[model samples]
Target: MARLRRRPRDPEGRMTLSEHLREFRRRLFIAAAAVIVGAVVAGFYYSEIFDLLTDPFYEYARNNPQVDASINFAEATAALSNLISLSIFVGIIGSSPVWLYQIWAFIVPGLTRKEKRISLAFLGATIPLFLLGCGLAYAILPQSLSILYGLSPSGTSNIQQASMYFSFVTRFILVFGIGFLFPVVLVGLNAIGAMPAARLIKGWRIAVVLIFVFAAVATPTADPFTMFVFALPLTALYFGAWLVCRRLDKRKAANRPDWLDVDDTEASQL
Candidate 1:
């Protein structure tokens, strides 16, 4: 019988740069595969997804008599292009959990056991928050379309290209989902001791400004109402995270031994 050979382990159990690259490649391939599978599944439900996305546009056209609005396919391949793009978008969203877990797994190797546990908790929180953001975007789609159409002059037909409209809708939802991830990132940084509650509190004004700016840029429409709708909740989440951090800091300080407070350069009093 032939003897089986074991793969050589890295010295000190630490992965080398080449090993790191290989691991990253593996994770990337898995994530891509998951996305492709998701896309295939989404393709099967293309009609349903199309209707769902176009619902807001139809609603706008139905109620508004001043302007005729319709999504038009300009080219012979435009419908196919839209279908492909929409399927990919749904694929990415549907496979978010798998990709998100892959990302978390990639980072887990470098984290301590405790940090890994904390990160797992955050990862669980992240998926739902992202979906929540997307749902909110879908909910406000009608209002955003209303605001945009309201700006168009009366008697002009708003013939929206199907590809452009779907692109805008997908981008809008993606931006919202990404926007909601910032608070989770903030909380994660706090958990890692990288960002303190005091620092967040001190930077409140700047943070608020930045949030509004992000909301402004993120929303598909230029209107302030959408911006406010996006920004206000995020601002609230920031403060809420700060409060959680503040409590965490207090708890940590209370649990810490007094001797640890002495600077490493100074002699400790017995």
Candidate 2:
């Protein structure tokens, strides 16, 4: 039987289990440190994220003549709280690369060569999916705001509190961000062999149902338009993932080692 290649450090040595705990601790510390630094930097730019988010409302208010357009914050403390919250959110998101890298590095020692390659592909696709969702949310914010604003009564339709406005936008961005990653998750499942490309293609009808179900469950707004907007991108992404999986599966079959196929299948099925 042919043997898998070993790294210099490994010298064909397998992990002793105790080393796994030590590595986990080291990666955790690095991830935590990165989070703290990102939080501080994002806190410094808190006003920017705030304004960047709230700019649509400001624009709509400034241009509109009939609605007496302005957001009214009821409490002084709300603004401060919003800043702190926004900073923390930005920090975590901004630090994702650092934390993600730390985690990948820590786990690399335990992974086989093929697993390492799939992990790298997953990391590559993750950023784009997340960004796609965030951009979609930003693009749709104006429409959402218009709908929300138009529903007001005769004389009293101002945003009475910053909390209300922030809550609305933040929820939209977050929901969209997570929702966009649906395709990536599906691709990862295929890469890991828990799901096969052929089976997923066969189950497209059920998959469509699941897509809507995810959109409905994940979306914070009950508005059908907003919910549909979220679902549509995910649907497109799902199809794109199928293409990627098809190519990847063909490559895997072409490159698969026959010796590992038999026993490994039984182990995995177990």
Candidate 3:
């Protein structure tokens, strides 16, 4: 019987489990430090960040005579806590590259050359796709707010809790951003040979239905227009991913000899 060969270890000598833990701790410390620095910088410009976050609400209020948009803090510590939390959020976003790189550095040594290439490609694609999703959410915010605000009775002013409002906005942005990465994940699966493009294409109708249902549920606004606003881009991205997977599958097939390929009839016989 023949034994399978193990792949070579990384050039850096292997260490005990304790050393790995220490390395992880060091990387975590660096990432934490970067976040702290970012938070400090963000703290200096808290007012600007606050204004930016509240712009959509203000714009909606300005246009609608009946809807008065104002955020209130119910507790004494609410304002300070909210500001601190906002600064932390800003810090994390600002220091994302540093922390992300640190994480990648920690994991890269364990991966093979092909795995490393795929990981790098995935990382490269993920950031921009996430940012684009966030951008789309930001663009949709004004309309979403307007739609929701319109629901209030004519005489009642819309007063929102500051922390709650911030949470909602954060969740909204994150959901959209992460949702946009679905296609990227699909592409990555295809690239890794875990999911075939043909399977994805075959399930197009179901996929579209699920996408729309998700958009409807995920969107904060209770309006069809906003649902479509979220769904349209995702639908486009899904099809785009399908095309990419199809091309990759074709390329992979092209690299193999024709005789090695089995026709459907031959495959059925086996």
Candidate 4:
């Protein structure tokens, strides 16, 4: 195989079509196998998982009463589908490490020593941030559900289909996970000094608006309580990111000075 030399910082390094295909297949197999293993393991606990998943609906059902009666045709199909989906979801989560490693390994060889260190640090920070986000989502899910359910008027609000519920739950986890990583991205930028704290502070107004907007949109729940809860944490993380970036920039400005300045993203470009 001809060694393809390219810049690691850019999204596009150099890779042949074959290389891409090969990597895709490799990642796919590993991901699939991991999911299968996870699903099998989870199969034993499927009933328990279903019960847990249905809790929010159950809560709503208990309170509303009519919601249970409103559900019928699609509900049964959705129930099984959702269980399967949840199993797949867990499998993917369990297998994430394998894929992460595969990705890291793919790029590691191409990276400089400096680049490798940066990549490792990013990986380290990212994994924890994502996990924290997922954990937070799980903790807040019941609350979010309650809040969403609370918004709807007392009617026959049948949340029948399991698929719909699963989608909502999985999406919640994903959005939270990605949202949590927002600060990490910003923090990484600050570490290298790409984003100045002063600028971030200046942009607070816009940032706050954006946070709320994101809360409004990203949230499938679309309930104010849920939106605010999600947005509040992200807003806090944003400031936290700013503070972190500020300190790093200050240190960078004081110490070794270069055209690179304190731009974190540029620094990470190895």
Candidate 5:
């Protein structure tokens, strides 16, 4: 007779150091594969994506004939390099859900089955928030480009290197997307018992200040409107996360065993 195969083990059990490393390696490989697959897909739509990225600059130039703004390739291989770089960036962003899940799974091996399922649901929320942030950044991109270009003297040629422009655009989008994920992080911390809602509520003043600072940096334009717009959603999300955490805390307290909460110094009446 053939030998019976071992049953699948839960990831939460105690493991040797090497086992942990192997698990990490496996997750990393899967995440990398997802990114590669996404990059391959992006390669097929390179032209459309390229045009979409560069359209803002072209539009600005078209609307203002006085400003001689043009994107130029400084090196012989600049175009090819930019294409590869752009593809990799798009891959990283498009496959973020996979990589992000891998990261979460690696750190959360101690989570209970119920907790894992709840956390997975939160992970699903990350994608939409990230994409929403990217969309908002893209919507405001034209104004940012205009603000930067307007600094140059009238009738002067503003020649921008292609690589630099793409780098700026991609970085801007990535930063905004990451910013929108802050609430999810807070909720995750609460879910893991690392942070409580009361603490978050207490630090609201400081958090608001930091959020404003982040919004200012994220929004390239000096105007207050853009900063407020960026900060508002984040502020709302922070409060939302706090509310969720408060509810979770209540549920956790209700489920706790009464004897566990008794004073350690005092004997329990048996």
Candidate 6:
């Protein structure tokens, strides 16, 4: 008996459009489910998380007698809402690896072997960098709170609303965490040949300016010190990425064939 011929496959593996859609849906559902599970787990630790989140403010208040720190719920449902919101945020963060893995799995079949290696490296770097950024933000929270709270008139107590405080803290942490990933993205682009080291090096000045601007904007406080705290590390990371890209470009150039070195003008004339 004759055997049936298999369908042709792309170098990166082949799938129909419908198959891709179904795969995407499956991955999305899994990621969502992971987040939900994380949230449920976090809900049990709501009080602990709340205390941990408020610790920075409390610490600042402790040192400064004039500054009064107390979080109040304005509405009847405000406390419950805050707890749920905090749980969701915590859940997403805690389950990041699961969702991130799902995303990577969904895309891996379409990537070349070398691309897959690079992607795995990126994934490894991303989680640590994000956690580092979050840690930095958490470390700076007390100082930031101190500066902002110090601005209030003497003898006046600062009554922070639970919802507003949580929102601010969440936004602050997320901004820093996401901001730190910018360099990883740059490196990934370079690895994929979408961006060359020369371009990044040439645009260093603009990149520095943008980094500072982003830091300033992302910082909850208007203080220059806080802005610098954010910008300095990010700037360092960007230059570090540039150095890596430069080295990569050199390696590529060394391996390139002489015939491939034709000038752009000469190639166009040909």
Question: TM-scores for all candidates?
Answer: 0.92, 0.84, 0.87, 0.75, 0.86, 0.91
Candidate 6 lDDT by residue in tens digits, 1-270: 999986665666679998789889999999999999999999999989999999998998789866667889999999889989999999999988889889898889988898899899889888989989998999999999888888888779989998899899998899889999999999999998988999998999999999999998877779887899999999999999999888888988899787677886675323
Error of 1 at 98 (Å): 0.3
Query: What lDDT does model 6 reach?
Result: 0.90
The lDDT per prediction is: 0.90, 0.80, 0.87, 0.75, 0.87, 0.90
Candidate 3: C-alpha lDDT: 0.87
**Residue 131 Cα positional deviation in candidate 6, in Å, after optimal superposition:** 0.9
Off by over 4 Å in 2: 1-18, 256-270
Ranking by lDDT: 1, 6, 5, 3, 2, 4
Tens-place lDDT digits, model 5, residues 1-270: 999986566666656787689989999999999999998888888898899999988888987888778999999999889888888999999999899899878866767888878788788989999999999888888877777787787668878999989988898888779899999899888988999999999999999999999999876567676688789889999999999899999999999888888898998765
TM-score rank order: 1, 6, 3, 5, 2, 4
TM-score of 4: 0.75
After TM-score superposition, what is the CA distance of residue 262 in candidate 5 from its true location, in Å?
6.6
Worst 10 residues of 4 by lDDT: 64-73
Colliding pairs, model 5:
none
The Cα error of candidate 2 at residue 145, in Å, is 1.7
Weakest ten-residue segment in model 5 by summed lDDT = 6-15
Candidate 2 C-alpha lDDT tens digits along 1-270: 999874346743356677668778889999998888888898888878878988888777766767777666677787788777777778777888888788778777778887889898888778777877888998988777776676778797675477777787878888898888888888889888877789878988888889888888877666677878887877788888899889889999999776566764365432
Q: State the local distance difference test value for candidate 4.
A: 0.75
Which parts of model 1 are misplaced by more than 4 Å?
6-13, 263-270
Q: Per-residue lDDT of 1-270 in model 4, one digit per residue for the tens?
A: 999885344343557777778767887787677779988787778888777766766665677655542333374476567667788877777666776777777777567776678667777777778888888887788777767666666654655555666777889888888888888788767655577789899999999899999888987777687788888999998998888778877776788646555476555433
- Model 1: lDDT equals 0.90
Candidate 2, residue 127: the lDDT equals: 75
